[model samples]
Target: MPAFAQDSDSETSNNTMKNTEYVTFYPSYGYQDEGLWRIPLRVWVHKHGGWGGKQLSKVAKRVVRNKAGLEELHQDQIEMFRFRFRDFVADSQSFEAIFLRFDQDPDEEVFRLQSADGDKRTNFNGLLFGELTLTFERAEELLTAQQSKNGWLRFTATGKDHQGEGAVRLIKPQGDSVISDIDDTVKITEITEGEAVVMMNTFFKPFQAVPQMKALYQTFDENVALHYVSGGPWQMYRPLADFLFKTAGFPPGSMHMKNVRLHLLEGETYGDFYRLIKLGSVASEQQKIRQISEIFSHFPQRGFTLIGDSGEHDPEVFAHIRNQFPEQVNAIIIRDVVNDATKNPERLQGMKVIQADSAFIDADG
Candidate 1:
């Protein structure tokens, strides 16, 4: 059994515990205990590396069945910790200590912890290699300590090969589904001629969704899964993720984009094949439709709605979906762009196509 240790110095002791241990804790404001709010303390452990250089013990900790389930972590009432490793130490260090405080109101169940309480302290004797002594008042006192007691202590540490650390917080949205677009959808004002090519080179400027679109997004974020499928390069994934969460208020979800390179070369180069198949511009869109179909097929209980502007091939792609899976598609809302909306009259005859403003009004109603 590995041992844990806590900081010994009184000055550092009052501060957050930054030491080599099995578990560390951090204070979370949103999560509460017995009326006291607390933070999550990520924990790390050492394990054997398995096949393909994968760490086997870390994998075991993430396994659902054993003792690693997210629910199990909450149920076991285990203190949360953050894991870290150091090149010199050759062991992991867990920082912070978190506990749950319960609320008296049965109807309003709440949990909290006093992370800043000066009274809280831990000790490292070196004998208990990976053991820790975390002392705190009962759950009810957590909030009181937060107000009257010393502020919570937080610590940072360096690590070599820290494992079994960090807790997973499950974020459950209330809305049913999230619908979005690609190209100029979250990127800058591109996806169209004239200004499209110019906007491509100008980076750093944030690519945000229109305000009205965000307002619409607030309507169905809780239950539905959000998806962003674009005809852009897969390299845009990270930047797009940041833009969506930071600027556009779009939650992370399944994102499909062009393969760029397929299993087998269709021509001299992948770009050649992409242009030959007219896929360079709409590859992600096709992949997105297939993904939507797959998701709807598996989850029949949830209804899906598609949203996009008619600037690009959205009309053609969405039309294909309506023809193929009319039953699965509850509604198709397309924002009119130029005269494309009028041109697709044949496709919009049966499906639902409305201007952006009109859709917002209907959503508000």
Candidate 2:
């Protein structure tokens, strides 16, 4: 959609190059409409270093050979092209610049500069990386290419020190709706409480839902936008984003959470303060409820569903949303936590409250 420069010419010239080449790969068609195909391409840049320094000598591309290959691409593939960098010496300063051009179109060119570690361990930048450009073509060509010889598409790119080539495919979008929690939703393992203090520091994987959630996530990802609201601090946005994209099966979308600095307090300790100030005061949960209300208020035509666990205030918060925004909320599903569904009779009355094991099935129904 937009143009990106991979590296600066100065940076490229500074590095010593034992070899420099460009490789192109086949293109992957992601989405097709009105004869236009959204193609995905993966390009890799490799470099070798000299006494002066390490430098990129070649760039390579990976193409999808089958539909199953599409799974290798991450969510960012929907909008951006990404690659992983591997094999570098420890503390060595070596980088590679990649320039991508599609079909001799100057305006479609994209660029990126990737650095490598000196160790052989192969470190990746972000789990996702890449650039996207629009291409105009008939969908028939894409479908035919898949079935015909040489019909499959490919990607070609030139690099300062290297080149790459590969195949491409048309990918279909996942249309699913996601209902998620915010606090332990994507960050620390547990909710923000006294126990969470130890849990957070225990080096446990972030609080992302287990892989079992993927089935439920896929159910709505193909059709509905993910709605993530949390009682946790909003500062965890970046980690949350990574968690959703990498661990949990949430597509890119907006996240809602409390302003901890403005709402949550210190001196009382995280746990005591949260329970005393957060649940004790309706302001925190109210903030989330109001956000949901605003969402339904603006998009009344779209179906809205509520997903939360009984661990914290999700039950009450979701119930409030259901009561206030009945027409917009298709269903409310709460994952049981404390086994005290009756604690909040007002929140449970007439609403669907299922155990975690059953919530997904009931939500699908």
Candidate 3:
């Protein structure tokens, strides 16, 4: 018999809530206490507002009004369109609580979460986002659950009329780990190529992995855990996971990302839309620092190899992180994206720099 079996089967198949959608995300494992493993549960509940031409037209018109402001307006339209329609569908439904359960385990249990506590779940401030990140306590039994060879354990989440599957990677406190950046380092999103290109590559184009990076990641033995820390908002987690782990064949690990919510703009100006994008860009550096610091602090006994690209503030951020946790951070690798003849020695003063084109052979030799 499974634990919490009653709660797992409690939600009935009611007619009114049949259209709900649940998107389960990669959850992070917390520290172990007296035989219990701490697992942070994350789930998104919304209405499936399918991608339709009418929705696109409505959003585009609200964003782009005249040709005089076409360029900036196009950028805003792209942002609104990508967020408002694809993947992230701001639901009209309001949920005060939800339930989650581990899959493929004989003793799997269901956990209930409330929305009153802002950090544990999305309060009124994040109601528009529908992202609930609640922590599960005394969950040590989960460690015995079946896990993929790379340490990922599967789980199912359900709320009202929605249901979905997600996984969490269990890592020990003491081990070698790799903390990689998603953007220019592993996946190719040209940050230095301006907003239009960034939006195009992120939303429209197929995601491409940096050549050799996947192979480099696979070289790590079982004792070495993996993690992906990025400035990209949590909304992009599903697509990014599919591209990196499923398609590119990189090992699965914990995902740490910025909490950003995008809602359909009602009577909002172009300046308002543009400002949100700008704020996210500026906050990227700080977000990475905070997330990486948390990971380092979470596993104080684990040594980390930080990987990022030179197209942005990665070099500076990694350098700062190393300064804070000099003992735990074993290496800081900056992938050279900026084309400087001298390898930009001053910019990459303290880190090991690699060229994307030759990183494989370079790392192997």
Candidate 4:
């Protein structure tokens, strides 16, 4: 939720700017507990392969875009990109420490710095990693949920070679929050079509949101916090957020996306295609389990409705979450993208699993 809490749903901004230089921050969202406000902000710095890779890429692009030529060009470009991107983790340095400042009410005021406090140093050991935390002991603005469940904090991150400024949101618990998946459930990725579909969706095509998702979410009153939790890589977090707010009229909340591992690739361009084969793997299954369960753990008392598609193991993963947090998980909603496993039912255990063709259909059940 880029704009914070909107209407009645949770508005946590999963914002990231795509740039060749400096660090990129994932869509940062936080919930206030009691008087404490915490934001798990993640940032990554890009030193780039710098001018060498840039010039080389330019030269390579001029050589023609054939498969053989493109592959070689990508290899060179990746090597160069990785080279400068590794200086932060060299043997000489244990970790690079970066300073940060937080302003509760960012304005030209008298007690500006006093209103907010994030004057601390965060140690970064990885080029692309979740670093630092903004902890506020007395978050009065955020604590006043009676007035409004949302508040904003302007923050600045500074290092020798990097500097960035952005706003972190605070959403105090209202009531039930919906944790939804992006791929097939909320958007049409054509998972049933496999590799060709993945390639088309990931690269050459415009992302399409599922029908009636915006109007469907609005049916629930303004207080239902809506969080989007997806296995999509952090690399595309911004694009996903853009689609949520701009393309679809759904209000934002906490958006949690998985980090991209360098090893999770088949090819620079065709890596996404491998997801078809990896769909039901034990590894991917466990990942989905951890991703969604951890969220349930964090907000133990908040009622949640788990939403995902049958394309992957969202059903099983959500099933595990229902078992793990029996009291917290309200219901498991799985969109039938593939087989109607719900007829006989898969491994749903004793939880209430609802299978539907669309999220808008039979959503009340």
Runs of candidate 4 exceeding 4 Å displacement? 1-21, 31-35, 47-137, 141-149, 152-167, 261-273, 276-280, 341-360
* Candidate 2, 296-343: lDDT as tens digits: 553545566677666667778777777776766777666554555656
Tell me the tens digit of each residue's lDDT in model 1 across 36-63: 3333332223121123212322332233
**TM-score versus the correct structure, for each prediction:** 0.45, 0.46, 0.76, 0.67
Sum up the clashes in candidate 4: 8
User: Residue 204 of model 4: what lDDT?
Assistant: 34
Predicted candidate 4 versus true structure: per-residue lDDT over 1-365, tens digit per residue: 23321111011121232221244445555665545555665554443334554454444333223321334434654443233223212121124444455544333222111112443223342333333333464445323422334454554544454444544556556467788888877777776675645544543356777775555666776666667776665545555665676667676666666543332222442243245222555665676777677666656678988877777777778877777888888777766666556444544444344444544455444
1-365 per-residue lDDT for model 3 (tens digits): 11110111112245454455544445555444345444555555544434453474457454443311334345654544444334444442344355667666565566565433443444442232222232343233443455345445566665455566666565667889898988888898777665556655665466788877766777889767777888776656767776787778776677877655445454343333333332335578887888888778778898999988877777778889989999998887877878532656787776777776675636532
Where model 3 places Cα greater than 4 Å from the true spot, the runs are 1-18, 33-35, 50-85, 114-122, 125-150, 261-280, 340-343
CA-lDDT, candidates in order: 0.39, 0.42, 0.61, 0.52
The TM-score-based order of candidates, best leading, equals 3, 4, 2, 1
Residue 281, model 4: lDDT of: 55
| lDDT accuracy of residue 308 in candidate 1 | 70
Whichever of 1 and 2 has more TM-score, that candidate is 2
On a 0 to 100 scale, what is the lDDT of residue 307 in model 1?
73
Q: Is candidate 3 or 4 superior in TM-score?
A: 3
Least lDDT summed over 10 consecutive residues: which range in candidate 3?
1-10
Root mean square deviation (Cα) for candidate 1:
17.6
